[model samples]
Target: MNDHTYKITAQDNILFVDASGPFDFDTMLQYKSETLEAIEKLKHEPWGCIACFHGSGVFSPEAEEELVLLTRERMRKNMAALATVIQDSRQADIQQMQLSRVYESCNTKYHIFSDVKAAKTWLANYLKKQPN
Candidate 1:
C-alpha cells in the first residue's frame, strides 16, 4: 500500500475513510479526489461519512484546513452527518476538537469517537433519522 494514499469505502449510504500514513497537502488532495469520486459513484441517495484515523500520522495545519474545506464540499453534495475515529491521544483529542470547532457553524451533525464501531454506529443511527 502506498504510504501517501488513504483508503475509502462505501457501505450502503455510509462513506468510510481510513487515514494511513502522515497526511500532508498532497496526500489530502489525493484523498479528496478519491473520496469525492467514491461518493459520486457509490451514493444511491443521501449519505454520511465515517473517518477513521487509527493509522494516520500527524496532520499539518494546511492539511487540516483542507479537511475542513473537503467537509464543506461534501456538505454541498448531500452529506448528512460525519463521525471520526482517532487514536486515544492528547494530540488527537486536541486536533479533533479543533476540527469540531470548524464545523460548529456549518449546521452539520458531527461527532468524534475513539472506537471505530462506535463511530459507525453513530453514523447508522444518524442515517436512520433522515427522510427516505
Candidate 2:
C-alpha cells in the first residue's frame, strides 16, 4: 500500500508487475529500481518478462527522466521482454517513450501494450521465433 512499494510475480522466466493501485512519487521510482533488481535476480530466467503497470500515480519529472535513462543504467543487467501497460486515464507518454528507448538501446525484444494478453503473446511468439 505504500507508494514506494510494488508487487512482483516472478515465474521461471517471467516477472510480472501488478502495479494496479495507488502510487505516489516514490512508488514510481521504486518501480524502476525494483524492476532493475528483478531483472538481475532473474537473469537466468529462461523466457524473460512481461511487466504490467495499472494504476494512478504522480510521476515526477525526475522519475520520468530516470525512466528514459534505464537504457544505460540497466540494459546490461537484463534481456527481458519489458511490456508496460497503463490506462487511458493516465499520462504514460513518458513511460511509453522510455520503453521504446529500451528497445532501441538494448539487445532485447521490447513491446508496448495496453493489454496483458497482447504483451504475453508477443513474448511467447518472440521466444519461439528466435534461433536456439
Candidate 3:
C-alpha cells in the first residue's frame, strides 16, 4: 500500500504541492501523473513550483529516481523554477542532497527553503523574472 500523500494545486502560474512522504516508487509515479495533469490545466506558460514537504520526507531509491525523471520532464514542459520547503533541518539537508542531484542533472533552477512564505515569495519573484 502507498503511504505517501500529496496535494497539488495551481495559482497564477505557480504549482503548489503539499506532500508528505516516506515515498515508494508507486507514490512517485502517482505524483508525476497528477502534477502533469495540473500542469496541463495551468493557463500560463513558464510556470514555477513551490513544493512543501512535511513529515519524514524521505524517498526510496526507486522513488527518487522517478522524481529525477519527473523533474526533467517538468522542465521540458516549461516549469521554470522550483522552491522546496522543509521544516526539519536534518531532513532539509537530506532532501537538498537528494534533490540537488535531480535538479542539477536536469539543469533546472531550484532553491531549498525552511519557510513556505519565503519559498512562495522567491518563486513569485523568480517566475516574474522569467520571459513569458
Candidate number achieving the greatest lDDT relative to the actual structure: 3
Q: Per-residue lDDT tens digits of candidate 2, residues 1-132? A: 454335877776677776653444466666777778776766653455676665453345665556556544554554445666665436567556655654675555677788888887888777666443
TM-score of each: 0.84, 0.66, 0.92
Candidate 1 segments whose C-alpha is farther than 4 A from its true place: 1-5, 42-44, 88-90
Error of 3 at 25 (Å): 0.3
Of 1 and 3, which scores higher on TM-score?
A: 3
Candidate 1 per-residue C-alpha lDDT over 10-126 given as tens digits, one digit per residue, 9 for 90 to 100: 877888887755678788787888878888954556789987775445666787778778878888888999898887444785657766866775767999888989888888988
lDDT (C-alpha) at residue 74 in model 2? 50
* Lowest lDDT block of 10, candidate 3: 87-96
How many pairs of residues collide in each model? Answer: 0, 0, 0
The reply for model 3, stretches above 4 Å from the true place, is none
How would you encode candidate 3's per-residue C-alpha lDDT over 1-132 as one tens digit per residue? 555778999987889999988788888888999988989866358999999888777888998899988998888789999999986545667877887888898999999888999999999988889887
Q: Which candidate number has the best TM-score? A: 3
Model 3 misses residue 126 by how many Å? 0.9
Error of 1 at 7 (Å): 1.0
Q: What RMSD does each model have against the real structure?
A: 2.6, 3.7, 1.6
